[model samples]
Target: MNIEKRVAELVDEKIAEINRPDVFLVSAKLHSNGKLIILIDGDKGVGIDECVQISRYVGFKLEEEDVIKTAYNLEVSSPGIDTPLVQPRQYTKNIGRNLSIKMADGSKREGTLRDATEDAVIIEEKIKEKGKKAEIVESTIPLEQISETKVLISFK
Candidate 1:
């Protein structure tokens, strides 16, 4: 069996008892970097030591199976809020939160995101000037125009 298939099977078995049905592994063959990147995403709520134990266990299993011998980089991480938005689901996580979206036209819009779904989002804003009342505007944006997306962390 190929390494990818073997790794998947091993991961499935390793995380079987762990309460992380959402965990997934992405096997990426980096052409530029010339390395195999295994991206692990899941909220296991386990400490770093536990995660390392899992990796070691997987390594032992793979070694026993003689699937791989050389060492490669294994990146275990919790998906961060600032990760560039890839799918609608990513945007869904940041709903009711502040966002800064870069548009194709080189202009960036910052607002409180009201809602976001598979294809679009609602942005609420207000414009005001001296001696003039504030004018509130709502903008609906399609996902295509979003060049990048990031979550706004509030310190207050």
Candidate 2:
């Protein structure tokens, strides 16, 4: 199965156990720079300490002690304003909101999200080159094409 799907399932199950459906999973990746960066939604009172606790707890559940091959860091946080634009389920969970997307060809688009599916996302936006009038534009992006995604926060 897809690694991300499996991870999401694991995270969802764990969050459910804690009764935090609002909970989302963010993971950290180790790069050649010797730094660890986690892709998580840092919100809902979850802190670094809490992230460690959850990581240990999840690792206990995974029990993959025999296969894991390298030292890794753990970080738990919210999906924040700029995370990867991944599964459609992620978008649907945040419908009627705004997000920024980078296309496969290095194009960036930002607009209010209308909806999402496992395959595509529909957005409502205003064309910047011409009229400021709002327009609804739907672009279908395969999961493979997404480089990154971030939640758009509106300042009231």
Best by TM-score: 1
Model 1 worst lDDT run, 10 consecutive residues:
26-35
* Angstrom error at residue 143, model 2: 4.2
**Against the true structure, what is every candidate's RMSD?**
4.8, 5.0
Candidate 1 lDDT, tens digit per residue, 39-115? 45443333565456457766677668876556655444444556665556556655778888898788988888888
As a whole number from 0 to 100, the lDDT of residue 34 in candidate 1 is 31
TM-scores of the models, in the order given: 0.60, 0.58
Clashing pairs in 1: none
The count of backbone overlaps in candidate 1 is 0
In the range 1-156, model 2's lDDT, one tens digit per residue, is 333355455566666777755556656444554333444442243556545656666555545632234454434454555556455557777777887877778988887888777777777765655757666666555656767778877889
Please list the residue runs of candidate 2 whose C-alpha ends up more than 4 Å from where it truly belongs after superposition.
Answer: 1-53, 59-72, 128-144
Model 1, TM vs. native: 0.60
Instruction: Assess candidate 2 and give its lDDT.
Output: 0.60
